[model samples]
Target: MKFRVKKATKNRTCIVSAAPYHPYQRCKAQGHVEFFSDFNKDSLFGVITFYQHKYENKVIVDGIFTTDIGIDGIKTSDGRPRYTAELYNEDEEMIFDLTSAVFNNAIQLVSIKKELINLEICGDEGIIGKAVVLKRGGEEIARAEVYRLDPIV
Candidate 1:
């Protein structure tokens, strides 16, 4: 099997709309909402096109991707919403899986080719720069880089 990977960001800050708008309007429209970076944007969400501002809020967020802001589910009280990141082979079948990932924050995995990875994350946040690997059964498939980002002023 093969896998592709990209550098992902952590604790990335971003602005979100705070108001409500009618239709066919961009986030810049009047009466729309705006939210400061009270949330940490994670790259594990993989191309977040849109997501609910709050798990119980009706607001739909077209969170900015250029700055890579928002979308990979924020810190849940009970981590109720679990995510499973899966890897597929040429036959389009899943082989490896990462279950119960915190906030289900899966990295922006490459989808063009194949790869092999090995990593450990039993007790992360202990190591300064710890990495993780995804495997299928006993075969290595992908790796994830865990790091923080400095605010770019």
Candidate 2:
């Protein structure tokens, strides 16, 4: 997917994770995540894949996501703007808040950095979640629903 990233300002920093949140917990199983627009369930926003594991001695989850949304347009109170995806369960309880990954291209539309990773949204079922574009103060501008695809094995 093509994405546009605004020019990176001086001191613009991107957060990258080098290790799993739960370094000690062994991954037991794997699952898939795909997002759809809230307005229309059939409209797909993107896909995220997660692994079942534990963090800080308690069970937790993390995943990687990719989409077509433009990243640089997002605003923040501080000069450091970022995007995030919030995942919820069937009960409408939020399970995870993911920070959008950093993109490398500053001049034009790029493809690789649109992929986000290591989103630590916690839940047991690993069935579904939601994606949204939040205004600086936490207002929703665009939103999508998360769905787990059936495993092949």
Candidate 2 residue 131 Cα shift, in angstroms, is 7.0
- Candidate 1 lowest-lDDT run of ten: 25-34
> What C-alpha root-mean-square deviation, in Å, does candidate 2 show against the real structure?
17.5
Candidate 1: segments with Cα more than 4 A from true spot? 1-98, 102-127
Q: Which candidate leads in TM-score?
A: 2
Model 2 stretches with alpha carbons more than 4 Å out: 1-46, 53-71, 74-81, 100-124, 129-136, 151-153
Tell me the lDDT of model 1 at 101.
Answer: 28
Q: 72-150 in candidate 2: lDDT tens per residue?
A: 3432345343345565556666655543432122212343433334443345533445443322246453455544444
- Predictions in order: lDDT: 0.29, 0.41
Q: Using lDDT as the measure, which candidate wins?
A: 2
